[model samples]
Target: MYRVQTSLTLLLSLATAIAGSVVHHDDSFQPDHILRVTAQNYTEACTTRYSVLVNGTSPGPELRLTEGQVSWIRVYNDMKDDNTTIHWHGLTAFTAPFSDGTPAASQWPIPAGHFFDYEVKPGIGTAGTYFYHSHVGFQAVTAKGPLIVDSNDDPPFGYHEERTIMLSDFFNETDKKIIDGLTSSPFKWSGETSAILVNGQSRQRTNSTGSCQLASICIEPGLSYRLRFIGATALSFLSLSIESHDLSIIEADGHYTKPLNTSFLQIGSGQRYSVLLKAKSEAVLKRAGKRQFYIQITTLERPKTLTNYAVLHYSSGTPADLTTVPLSPPLPTAKTVQGWLDHKLECLHPDHAFPTLNEVTRRIIIDVHQNVSDHVIWLQNGYDWVQSFPQSPYLVDIYTGRLDTGGLYQRAISQGHGFDNITRTFPARIGEVLEIVWQNRGTFTNGGLDVHPFHAHGRHFYDIGGGDGEYNATSNEERLKSSRPIQRDTSMLYRYREKTTPLAPSGWRAWRVRVTEAGVWMFHCHVLQHMVMGMQTVFIFGDRNDVMAQSDPVDAGYLTYGGSAYGNTTHSPVVRQYFD
Candidate 1:
C-alpha cells in the first residue's frame, strides 16, 4: 500500500509523506454547525426559479470534519413548501444509524418549517472526500455542497494547499419542472443538461463557452495543491482534465488509494476524489508566459456533450495569456470506462486490503432494469422501493414489532414482479460478510450509454471486480487473483457496448462487504430520476433491536416528522415528493 510521492522536490520527502499512511482514530473533532434550509429564487443558465438552498447558498457551505469525531449539525427547514432531509453523503454514520437521513428507511423527512439535528460520526479511519445533499427529491440538484473529512494526522501525501472542484450539471428548466416530467403519467424523460458547472460557475448556454466565467482556484508556484473533486450532478457522468497537468489520484470516497496517474478523470454522480496537482515553478511559468491553466470538464456517456472550464491561477507571474491554454477534450468511449474499472485502485491502508476469504455468509445477484408496463419504472431486485400505505419508517416500525422479517419478505413476494427470493429489504446478521452483485440488462450499446453509479449509505464496500455481461463466480475467481479490491462508497457499473446481444446484460459490478454496522442502509442508483422511478432498496444489517439501540430517540424531530411513531398526534406538513 505504497502511496505515490509527489515528484516535486519542494514538497515533503517520501519518508515524511508516507509516515501518515496508517490512519489512526481521532476523537477530538467536535463541530457544532447550523444549516438553515430555505427555498429562494436562483438564476442559473438564464433561468430564475425557486431552488433549495442551505444556509442561503445554492451549493451550501463546505463542512469541515475530523476523523472519529462526532459532530452535530442542526438543520432548520425554512422552506415554506417542500420537505427536506440532509443525507451526509459518504459519511458512514457508523455510531447512529438514524443519522443516515434517508426517508422512511432511516427516518422521516424534516417537514417544512421544522428542524432536525443530524449527528455525523465518521469512523476513526473513515475520513476523506464526501458531500451532503438534500435526500428528499429534486432538491439535490442545487442543494448540495462539498464535505471534507480530514484524517487525525497529516494526509499520506504532501500538499501545500487544497481546493474543491465540485462539478455539477445545470438545466435551463427548474427542478420542479424536471421532477414533474419524470413523474408524469406518460413519463416524459428529463432531457440532457443545458450547461456544465464547475463550482457553480458557468455562463449561459450559447454557441461558444470561450467567454464563460469559469470557476477559479489560486495557486502558488512550486507547491502541491490537493484538488478534491466531487461529482454532484443529477444525471451527468463527467470526464475532467487539466491543461498540461496529469492528475495523481490519492483518495476516493474517503478511502486512501495508491495514487492513480491519469490525464483524464471520470467521475460518476455521488462519487468524490482527492487528486494531487503540483503547480509549476514561477520560473517555468515565466518562461512559458502562462500563469493560468484550464481545468476542463466535459459531460460523458450520453449523446450530446457539454464542456466547462475552471482556471488554475498562479500567485506570482506575468498575467497568463489565457487564450493560449489549449483544450483538446478527449473523446470518451466504452474502452475508457472499461480501463477504469479494470485498473485496480489499491487501498493505501495496509489493514484494508482485499480479503482472501473462501466464502461469504450471503451472496446476492440483483438484475437492474428500466421497464415500462402500465408506466415507466425502474426496478431493483424486482421490487418497487415504495412501500404500500400505512407506510412508516422501517427503523421505527421494525423496532416496534410492526414489521417482521417474514411479513416483509412475504409482502415483497406478493407485490414484486421478479426475484421473489429477494425482497426490497435484504436482511443480514451483524458481522456477516456479504457479497452483492449488480447485473444491468436490456440496454442497447448503439446509442444508449446509461451508466449507473451505485451509492451505498451507512457504509462503504470493497469493490472486488466488474465486467461486461452476466456475472460468473467461477470467472470472477480469476479476477480475485489479480484484483486489489478498493473500498469505496460509490462505484459506477459501466454499460457494455454489445450491439450483437441486444437482450444480454450490459455489465456487472460486485461489492464484498462485511456487515458491521447495524442499520437499514440504502443502496441505490445515483441518478436522481432513476431513484425517483424506484431504483432503490435497503440492506438491513443486524436486527431491529440492534438498530433501535443505536438510533436516535423515538421522539427526535426527524423521527416524528412523517414517521408513524407520532403521525396520528403530530402536525407536520405532508410531503410526497420522492417516489417512496
Candidate 2:
C-alpha cells in the first residue's frame, strides 16, 4: 500500500488499471504534498516588492517522491487575491497527462483561497532533476522550488555528498507590474534583471565584501560532491563557474549523460544538470592558502550583464570564519562561442532508453518572429496567441463534449506543415511519430538574435540538436543512424548574426515525439518574456471522438472553475489500454 511519509504530503493506493507496471523503490511509494502558495512582501537587493512564495517563502520548499506509484499534490493558494498553479518541471509523466498544471491549457489556475489536488504518477524513467513552479503569468520568477525523485536502483554515478544550486534572475518590481509593461499597447519593455541570484542571495556592490549575503555550502577537503544545478531564471542566460575546480556532468534533464568535463558551463531558464565536483585535497589547499571559493555567475551574450556569487566553504577543524572570501578565478570559454550546447552529450544508458534520434511520420515547422504590427506581438506561423486565460480550459472542453475546433487547422507553408490556431491547438492520433522544428527568425524590428529555450509541457522529445541555419532533414538522414541524442525537456533554438528574413531562417532546432499519452499539452518557448508575446502553442494527442469515447469520469473538483462538467468520465485513461 502507498502511504504518506511527510507531514505536508500524503498518498493513496495505486489504481488497478496499470497495477503491475509501476516501479517501486521499497515495494511501495509515499508522500502527496500539500504545497501552500502565497504572495509575501519582502525586501531584497535594497528594494521592496511582493512575490508569489510557496509555503510563505521564495524558492519554496523541496518535495521528494519515489518513482512509480500515483501521488497527489494539493496546491492551496493561500494568497489574499492572486490565483496560482504549480507545474512539475520534469517527470515520467510528460506534461500531457491531466493536472500537469498550465493555467488555461491543461486546467484553470488554482483560485486564491481555494485548492486543487494534482494526481499524477511518475513512471520508472523519471528519477532525476525536476522542480515545481507557478506557471501562471510571471510567477515562476519567485514561486519555484526543487522536486526530487529517488531512483529505485542505485544511480549510475557515485558521490560522497549532494546539494542543490538554484540560479535565478531577480526583478525588484512585482510580477503583475512587469507583465503589464510587456503586454502594454505601446510595448513598454521590462529592462534587464535587477540582480542575478544564487540560492536567493548575492554579494553587495561595495569596495568591501563584509556585507555579502551569498549562499554557502560546507565541504570536506577531499570528497566527491554531486551538485544539482537548476536554471530557474526567467529572462537571462547565464554562465556559472567555481574557483580552481572542474565540473564533470553526469546528467541533464534527469537522464544520465556521458561525462563531459568543463571549467564552467552555461545554463538557460528551465534547464537542469547534475555535475560531479571533487573537492581539493588538504595538500592542494595548504599550497593555495584558502578554504573558501566563490561560485560565480554572470549573464551571457548581453551588452550589460549581471553577476552574483555563492561560497563553497571548507569545513574547519574548529569554529572559524567560513565567510572569508577567496580570490576570484578567470572566466572559462563560452561553449556557444564554438556553437551549440555540446551535442557531444550522448545517452550514457542507451539500453535503458528509447531508440536513437531517428525517423518520424510527420514534421511540423514553426517560424518564430516579432510581428510587424500596430502593437507588439510575437507570431508562430502567422498566428498571434492573444489569450492568456481561455473561457474553457482545453482538457475540460474535450472531456465535457465542448471541444472547440473553431479556427484550428493545418497550416501549410513554404517552410513545411504546422498548425494554425486562434485557440492555439492541433491534434495528432496515437501511434504517430511527430517531428517539431523551430525556425527562429527573431524580429524585423531589431536585428537581435534571441536564443529561445523552447519547452513542451507534456512531451520530452528525442532532441535533434540546433545550429545557425535552416534545418535540413535530407542532409541529416545518414547522421541519425550512429547517434543516440540525450533527451531534453528544455532545449535552445539558436539565432545567428547572419542577415535573413522570417521566411529565411537564421537558425533552427528540432525534436521527435511519439504520441503515447492522450491529453491536451502546452508547447512554447521556456523564456517567459517570449511567451508573454505569444511564442506558444498547444498539442492534443488522439482524435476528439476517440478521446471522449474512451475517457474516464471527471472529478467534481476539476469541473468547478473553467473546467466543464461532463455527464460521465473517469479519472483513469481507459483509452491507453489499447496500446501495445
Candidate 3:
C-alpha cells in the first residue's frame, strides 16, 4: 500500500513540472517598444502654460497595444528641473506591482534629465479605454494621453468608427501657484476652472464674442461611433451631453460591461468610459436642415455656473465647413438641470451588474474627513500621506524590515495630526479578498458634504454597493449583495446630507478587491488638490516570505537605475547623454 501511494505522488509531481515548462517556453510574445516621452514648456490653450509634453504634443502620443501583450516603455524626463513618473492608470501590473508607476509607493519619481523603463504586462482580462499620465506633482493635468488596448477578439458590439475624447478642466494659473494656494494658511481651494477643453481645444471666449474653433468630429448620418471619454480633470465633476442623442455605455475603466443607455453621463476625475453613439439617420438630418449638433459640458461644482461647448457635424457627402454651422443652443434651465441631477442621484455607473465579488476575507472601514491646523488637510482614517524619498521607498522599507509594525494605528489623535506623524500603511496577504468601506465624515468648516472621486492603483475592484449615511453591516445588508457589480478603478464617494429634523446618514462607498499583486499600492482621492493635501494610503500586500518568492528581478534593475543621480555623469551613461 505504501509503495502504491508513493508512485501516485511521484507521477503527479512530474506532470506539474511539465505543465510549468510549457508555459515558460511559449515563444509567441512580441518585442517591446521604447517610448521616449519628453516633458517641456509649451504655449497652448490661449496661454503660455508650463506643460509637460509627451513627444512635443500637449496630449502626447497614443500608445496602441494588444491585450495581454507585454510592453516595454522608456520615458525620458527632459524637464529642466521638475521630477515626474508616468502611471499606467488603469492597468493592474498583476504580480509585477513595482511597475504600477506610483511615486514613493511602488518606485521613485523619474528625476529631470533621466530615464525609467516601465515593463507592463496587463493581465488577461484587462482590455479597453485606458490612459497614461504623470504620477507625480500636477503633471497629469497637462502631460497625458490615451493608452488603448485592443481585445484579442472582436467586441460583443459593433461600431463603424472610433474617437478618443479626453476631457480636462484648464486653469490659467500655473501648477506651482495652485499648489501654493492649496497648502497655504487659511487653505484656499481652487475657486473655479478658467476653461474646459475637449481634445485639447476650446473656443477662447473674448467678451462673449469668439470664433468657435473647438474640436469638431465629422461623421456620416447612419453609422455607429465609439466615443472613448476620459475625464482627466484636476478638480472638476462634469455633466456631459449631446443635443439629441443617447450614449450606450459599453466599457468603463478598461473593463467591459453590459450595455446601458443614458441621456447624460456624470464623469468624475480619473474616470474613463467607452460609449457607442449611433448617428441620426440620413433622412432625419435632411428634414432638420442642420448637419451640426452641440456637445455641451457643464461643471457640477461651485464658484459659478460654467459651461463649454463643442460641435459634432454629420454629413453624407463632403464635410461641412465650420463657418457655415449654426451656433449651439442656449444652456439648459435651472429646472431642467435639476431634473438631470435627479436622474443620476443614485450615483451608480451605467452598468450595475458585472464582475461580481468573491467571498471577502477581510474588511477595512475608513473615515474620510478634513482637519484644519495651520492649513486645511484631508485625512483618511485620521492620517495624511507625505511623500518619502525614492531611495527609501515604502516597499523597500517594508521589505528590509525598516518599517515599524507596532506604530501602525487605525486612527490618529487630533493633537498628533501634524507633519511629524509617521506614514500609515495597511498590510494584506496575497490571495486574500478585502472589502474596503469608505465613509464620508463631514468636513471641519463646511457641511462636509462634497463629492470625492476615489482611485486605486495597480488593480480594479468590484464596486459592490454604496448608500447615503454611515455604513452599518446590519442596516445596509441589501446594498451589499449584488450578483453583477461594476468593476472599476475609480469611483465617486458622494457627500452626506446635513441632518435637519431627523439625523441623515453619512455617505459611504464599499468596494471589494482580491489581493493578487505583491507590492505596495496607493488608494487616494482622484482630485489632484485633495491628493496633494494628503488624502491617501498604501496597501502592502504579502508577507516577507510571499514577497520574496514573487519578487521581480526587472524591478530591482530599474530601482538601481532610478537611484543613480544625474550629477554622477561618469558612473551613469544614460544620464550623461541626456544632461550633456
Candidate 4:
C-alpha cells in the first residue's frame, strides 16, 4: 500500500510540473505581449507615493489584440505585501476560472515577485472599448488599462477610423494613508480629488501634446471619425458637449444604440460612448467647396482646478462655411422599453407584480451609503471586503435575513469587507425580468449620488427613471414617463446636485433597472473612487433556457488545476460564485 501511494504521489507531482511548464511554452503564448506591472513606492513632489503593487508604472499599458485571437498575458507582482490578480473587464472565456483574478474566488493571488500567466482566448467576437484592472483590494489604484480588440473584418458599427480615450483622476497620496484614515474614523468627508488625467498624463497644463485643449481636433470639411470615450473618474458625473459641433452617438457600453444626434450628452464613471462626428464648416467649402467642423469634448462638472480638456483642431485651407443643425427630438417609445420597464417594477415587487410586466420573477436592492471623514474617506454599503470570507450565491430562492447581520449574507459569502466596502452578490432568474432599485441614503454631509454608469453582461434593458429620492418634476416629464431611452448594457444615473452635503439629489439619484438576461453580471458605480468605497454588486441569471438545468457546473474558471478554492467564496455552499 505504501509503495502504491508513493508511486501515485510522484506521478501527480510530475504531471503538475509538466502542466505548469507547458502552459508557458504553448505556440499561442506571447510573453512579449504580456502587460508587465510594477507597483513600487516613489517620492512625487516630496510626498511618498505608493502606486499600488503593479507589474509596471502608470496603470500598466494599453493591450491591442484581434478577435478570436489566443494570447498569453503574464502578470508579475513586485509588492512586498498584499496579493493581486487582474480582471479582463467584459471579456468572455471558457477555462476562465483560472484567470478570473478575484482573490479566493477564481484563483489564488500572485504572491510578491511571482508571475502568473493568463491564457486568454479573446471572446470569438469581442471588438470594442474594454478595460482590465486589478481585482486585489483597491489594486485598481495601480492596475487599469485599455484592452483594445481590433476587427476591421466586420465592424459592429460601420466606422472608418476609431480613437480610444480613457479618463482618470489622480491622487498623490498613498493608499495606506488613505485607508488608515478612513478606518480610524469612518465618519468624515474624504473626497479629496484634485486632478484629472486623459490616458495616464495629467494634462493639467499642456506640454507638447496639442489635444489637451477642448478644441484641438481638426477635420477636413467632410470626413467622419469614430471616437470611443470612457469616463473613468473616481467621483464625478461627466456632462459632455461640443462648443459648436454636433455629435451622433452610435453606441453605448460597446453595444450599438439607435443613433441620436445632439450637441450635448452625459457620461458617468465606468461608462463608454462611441460617437460619429461629421465635419461641415464653410471654411472647408471655400478651400474644397465644402463645410469643415472640429470635434470638441468638455465636461459639465468643471473641476475646481481644471486642465487637459479634450479638443479637436480643424483648419480650413480656404474659407469654409459651417452650418448649424437643430437638435433632434428625444427617441419615441419602443416596445423593448415599455416591456423592460414593466418587468423591472414587477421584479421589485414580486408578490404584487406589475400588471403591465411581461416577465418578472425577482428583485434586488443595492443601497449605497457614504462615509465622510478627513483622512480615510469613502462609501460603505455594508462593511469592508475580506478575501477569506465566503460570499453568498447571487441566485437563491429565498434569503434568511437572520444570516444577514452586520454584512453577513448567504448570497455574498462575505459582504463589504475591503477597500470599497461594496457587496458583490445578487440573485436573479434568467429572462425573469429582474428589477434593481438603487437607494442612496445620504449618511454623510458631503454624500450625494455620483452618477453610476450601470452595465450588464449578456443583455440590456430599458431605463425607467432615476430621481433624487423622488422623480424630477422640473425636467422633461414626458421623456421620463414615456421611457427616457431604450439603452442597452449602459445607462447613467444623472447628477442632480453639486452641494457639498449629501442632500443634493444630483439629478435622478434613484434608478430602476429591468434584468433580461440569464448569466452572472456586475453592476457598479462608474466613479472609480466610489467603487473603491464598496459601490459594486453581482447578480446571477440562472440558465433559464435549460429549465431542468439546476446544477450549474461550478464555473471552473473559479478554480485552478492545483485543486485549490477560488470564486471568492469563503462561505458554506459558496457565496462568491456570482461575482467571480
lDDT of each: 0.70, 0.69, 0.66, 0.47
The segments of candidate 1 whose C-alpha lies over 4 angstroms from its true place after superposition are 1-31, 204-212, 317-335, 339-343, 386-390, 406-423, 443-449, 498-503, 549-553, 556-559, 562-580
Error of 3 at 300 (Å): 0.9
Between the candidate structures 1 and 3, which one is better when assessed by lDDT? 1
Among all candidates shown, the one with the greatest TM-score: 2
Candidate 2 wrong stretches, greater than 4 Å: 1-31, 92-97, 207-212, 317-329, 332-335, 351-358, 372-374, 386-389, 404-416, 498-503, 545-551, 562-580
The per-residue C-alpha lDDT of model 3 at residue 268 equals 86
- Please give, for residues 1-580, the per-residue lDDT of candidate 3 as tens digits: 0001123433342233111010110123232554445654565555667666777776777888777766756677777777777888888644243567787887667777776656566667676888888888777778888888888888767999998998887777777778778789977776678777787766654424444466787788799999999998888888888888889888888877667788878888988988999999988988988788878888775547567777788865656453332344344622123212211222233543222333556567777887766798887776788564324677666556666433432222222321114556666655556778887877655544567889988668877656777777655455444245667888878764542122233678888776664567888898888888888877766555454445522223334435642212233322111000
Q: By lDDT, is 2 or 3 better?
A: 2
TM-score of each: 0.84, 0.86, 0.82, 0.64
Candidate 1 lDDT, 1-580, residue by residue in tens: 1111122321222112111011111234222887888888876544566788888876889999888776767677887878888898988645354567788787777777666556576778877888999887788888888888878998888888899888887776677888778778877878888777777776533435345455677888899989999999988888888877888989988888888888878899998989998889878887988677777777777777667667778876355433332344433332245637454677786653344545465567777776664367776655667523127777767766676755554443354321333345776655556678888777332223357899998768888778887888788878777767888888988876633243367788988876655677889998888888778877776666555444422443334554422122144222111100
* Candidate 3 steric clashes: 6
Clashes of each: 0, 8, 6, 87
Task: Tell me the tens digit of each residue's lDDT in model 2 across 112-195.
Answer: 666655666666877888788988888898899988878888888889999988887788778888889888877777778877
Q: What ranking of all candidate models by lDDT puts the best one first? A: 1, 2, 3, 4
